[model samples]
Target chain A: MISRHGTPEHLPVRPFVALVALAVSVATFLWAGTAFAQASAAWPRVSPITIVINQSPWFGGFSKVVEAYEKETGNKVTLDVNPFAGSGEKQRNSVRSKEGQFDILVMNSAWLAEFYHGGFLTPLNTIDPAFKLDPQVMSYDDTGYWDAARKSNNAKTGVVYGVPINGNIQVLYYRADLYEKAGLKVPQTWEELAANAKALNSPPNVYGMVQRGARSASDISYDWMPYLHSHNGAIFKDEKAGDFTVTINSPEARQALDVYVNLAKTVGPPNPGSYGQAQVIQALLTGKAAHATPVIAAWPQLDDATKSAVVGKVNVAVLPHGPGGRTTPTLGHFIGGIPNNIPKDRQVAALAFLRWFQSYDAQVKYAQTGQPPIRSDVYAAAFMKTPEYRWSPAVLASLPNAKMMYTVPEGPQIASVLELRLNQAVLGEKTTADALNTAAAEIHDLMQKAGYKTARLPPLK
Target chain B: MRGTADRASAKAADRWRFYTLAPALAVYLLLALLPIVNLATMSVHDIHWQQGAARWTLVGMKHYAELPRDVLVRAGLANTALFALIAVTAEMLIGFALALFVSRIAVGRVLYRTIFLLPILLPGIVIGAIWKLMYNPDFGVINQLLHLLGLPGFDWLGSGSLAFLSVIIVDVWHWTPFVFLLLLAGLETLPQDIHEAAMLDGASAWQELRDVTIPMMVPILVMTLAFRLIVSFKVFDEVYLLTGGGPGTATEVLSFTIYRRFFTEDRMGYGSAISVIALFLLTLVIVLFMGMARRRMHAH
Candidate 1:
């Protein structure tokens, strides 16, 4: 309604233009604020990632983490859970055949070398994916990590492939009431363990010990590791030697096998040679067994009144000492990694998920949910205050001495080779020494054929 | 010219039929034969994903040569033979009796047949799980029943040869129905004249069973026994679920052995070699049995 030169009905064109500019300025400011808020809430929605996991507590715990990450980052996580039997092999077969279904894969630490060398795993360091671990959501405390755990995933070239998630260590689970009634001490040596077991055992009612003696790559091998390690036997003499020669044939190994075979014959479950951890666990839970060497991670289930019959009646102690004068349990851990086939963005997203998952809060929740913790700090004074986590002290005690299984490119194959022979010894089909020697020879042949630097070391002096 | 036209039209019709069937035939070849050819090829090559991307190298018959010396393979073969012998024998005898008994019944024959068929209709996994529960040494109903009878309980799946026998029991329970159904069909198809003549001759039930039923059911019996052997040799799911070829490989069979080699050990080439060998063994058994069956038919 304005005319130029101050006419009566004219308004100033500059004022109209200024009014329009003012409205535009206010609207722009409001839009900018909303956009900033939205950006912070969800920066980039990642393409969906597929994951494979066994039905371990870690898998269950990670499902919760997946839900949390989805809300936080606007990314969808697809979980493919495998059953307890042969899940490891299925994952490997599918991924190696380029099924293109998975973005992330989780496997045992024993399998790290096999997967890494096979190019199925991406080196986490190249992407430094752990950097995506949010400090607020995840514990960044260096002290929280166990010895070498933080850096254990690093390859020889200093590339990191796997991120440690959950770990396992073995402890002696004993019937405390039975021990008290029998007037026995917690056995410290293998000789004492056998004697105590034999003393407490009565046929057809109660047995001295229950153990997994089934001839499987995972089942009985894990049960045997503690004895093997406690006897100072190892699968390899010097991994650094490059030839990676196995040392399971030493006298120490034979001694361990002898103890195992004797236990099955004298005080173990009636058919211990045919059963695995499930049977052993069943025996212990039902009060049929007075002693067992169950993984500490699984002990919480034994303490829960809802799941176990021997709640509060069972107690944990260090594993009985072998000839080496100390107790040792075989080391096992489930580790997570981005598959090498994943594009960089998906790998980064997987890293983000892991970083948060391995955070302190998540590990605490993991422990709360009956999984053994991978962190050192979880057992520190403040965390173990909860009464439900009855085996934390024993787990902490066992962690320092846990010996990881042979981790090599040929690890899975080596395990099968060793398990078959070990079981043969258990069944009295072969003498302990004979089984060890045969197994060692076969493994040596396998390594030599695989073209590793081939040198068989003499017995450790 | 008219005859040539007619021939041309008939040829066109035949070609059309083949074209219509081509897609299905192609799919069948792809699904069945390709993997077999690939497995044979792989058996001769050292192909494993142990180093990640399956490293393929031609290794000849190394895996086959290793089979005899391989302890697991030998154990698997022994166990499979024992399983086939025990399980097939039990099922055949029991199934034959049940068929004869049911056929003699004048009432509720359909109901009895359905009840007998129930176990086979259930999935193998379900049967395995149910039996595993029943075999549990501690609280399983089987042990409880033993206790009620004031007899000592046995560790059904936990000890020595018991594990093998336990798996056989499961196989029997699941597959006896199949034998019964087949033999019952054979029994029904038999001419009533033969049985009538036996009855008219004042033959007792035992005599009739021995002379008439036994001789008449020979073809079906042979087929059933031979088929059961092949299925029993390939016993995997039941054993895998129940005992996992355990109690120190007491129940290990050829299929389970192949699975262990192929998957657990990551030795695809070795496993393929074992499979090829098993294929040949099974083929030989089938061919020999078929030839024997033909001979027996001719004799009849």
Candidate 2:
């Protein structure tokens, strides 16, 4: 098609440009195809398989175990790790939206109800019996799984939905140096704790105590649940009736809020409403406060040089008693479950990986890293015998009595209301009674809107 | 014969020009007009999310009936109107002054013009984030400067009243440049002979400006005001990131309210209703503005 020399030269350039464009397009298409093929291949295969963990400590120890398992079995094992923070709700929501994205989800027990109800997770009972009996397999402790946590994991039809991965119970953290300076012992009751807090108040440099006052799902709800339970407050009465009728408007709940708000006002910093889990930890770590009630999972941060200022001076104990005369810690734990959409072969591989991770050896390794083990035997193992972790066993022993947050479909919404009302009371915008009454009314209205029946009061025992 | 055919065709075209506009009208109806009609229909319904299913039922003007009684909704509407009035007025005044100054400049005029348009070039989100850091209570430059001046630091985004002002300030900073650029272009294209003639007659600068320049700039000014009003009415990003509609819903604008209903509350029907009401209100305001401009133009 060449005519003039100039036109011929121009024609070559055009073809060259076209050739480059075609090559680029082909390369891109092949690249995309290969990526898709690689992604599909990464999906769990039937034989000895791979399990991806999107959690913390479990991924740490489980990764090594998976490698060993594959080496011994002569089958390839792949594990992917995803770390998250704050509440685990976002992670749970992710799995619910994208099934098969995770072969096994490492999630908090609090989310089990939502997961099971939404059909996002598979029940462990359906796994192959051989892998189910694998002692190395991580499974929920039949005895150690407390009533609240168990009830949370129980499907409406009474089927177990998840295997407990680790246990977490709330504890009171205090600075021993400050307690000594104030000539106070560890507070045993809420009244005593308040007294100690007031005594330890030193002004702009330091405060007596700090807790999570921030308005968020986890920050406000975590510490409040124990207080509600200690004072015998019930979020709801009848599950079948869907009655989310009663709230923390009872005398006990009010007393708890009153005590909590009063202490937060007098001893808390200028902006108590902005404080959350990390801030509470910072209060104790930087010696800004003498005490805080945080989950046991955060205790490890106290010893990390980068995070804590009072490494050796910090100590942990069960939460103080309320009017009930019994200390009740809130139980929080992570559990593992297979996705129902995962291929059957991959499910077997996930079960195999879980069995190894839950073995006594692996659990002990996890305990040594400062996470509480779910197994009864692991609590008395070599890890707990160490001086650094001697108190962890005591914390673990208290897990049996710990209470979980309410697990109804409306649980999150009710918790949001409580958080908002509690924040108002703490900020002195409303009295404890006033806040509770308003919250109770709002919660009752929400329950009615959800079509739940009103619960009748039970006769006294 | 061809010339006669062409003349006849041209005459017939004049009679059927309306048909030529039909496709555009059809597209607008399908995309914009129809969705608005659908939104108005959906607004009066209750909707909830259960097991990934959205259930909706007609509640009739119940949401609207409740609107007057809902204190937060009322406060939000009042705040939005107040924000639009104050913020748009300030932006227009400041923008006009900048455009006038830059238009009179000689040396480095192009450079100054580019610099004047720089704020408009940056994204809204970036502007909001930069302003948020500036207003931070603890280590922000604003507080640091206040401390340097031996004055007590103030919570810019933390205080309810100040948070609203802070968002307005950021809006003016980002969007005034847009108005300035528009006005500057209008200023450049204005007829100079009228101003020169007035100056020759010993007319005072204020008199000449009030009587000549401003009158000529009417159409451009109206266009700028209309554009800014529409944008300011949908203020979302800055307020959302800055205050999150909080320190107790002080900065909760209508857009933020609609977003919360749609995403957080999962009440799509209620959200759709709010959107419909907002759309209707916006349309009414625009029409009123156009009428006023038309009247002013006719009077001139």
List RMSD in Å for every model shown: 8.9, 11.2
Per-residue lDDT tens digits of candidate 1, residues B1-300? 999999999999999999999999999999999888989998999875533477699999888888898877998988888888899999999998899888889899999999999999999878888998998887789999999999988888877768888889899999999999999999999999999999999999899989898888898999988888789878899888888777677888899989988876678899999999998898888899899988987787
Residue A22 C-alpha lDDT in model 1: 97
Query: Judged by lDDT, which candidate is best?
Result: 1
Lowest lDDT 10-residue stretch of candidate 2 chain A: A141-150
DockQ of each: 0.48, 0.09
- In Å, residue A423's CA in model 1 sits off its true spot by 2.1
In candidate 2, what are the lDDT values of residues A173-232, reduced to their tens digit?
A: 887777777678888788888898888888767788787776544466677777777766
Q: Provide backbone clash counts, one per model.
A: 8, 4
Residues A1-461, candidate 1, lDDT per residue (tens digit)? Answer: 43455554654567788999999999999997776567445445556777777786346556775676676556788888887545576667666765445677767655655665566766566677335323332121111222133222323324545566667667898888888888999888889989989987887678887788887767777888888878887777765334466788887887888898898889976767777777778787777888898776567668768878888888888898786457887766666777766577887777766765666666766666667666667666365766666577777777667666765657767888777778878888788877887888788878887777655545322
Q: After TM-score superposition, what is the CA distance of residue B72 in candidate 2 from its true location, in Å? A: 4.9
Model 1 earns a TM-score of: 0.86
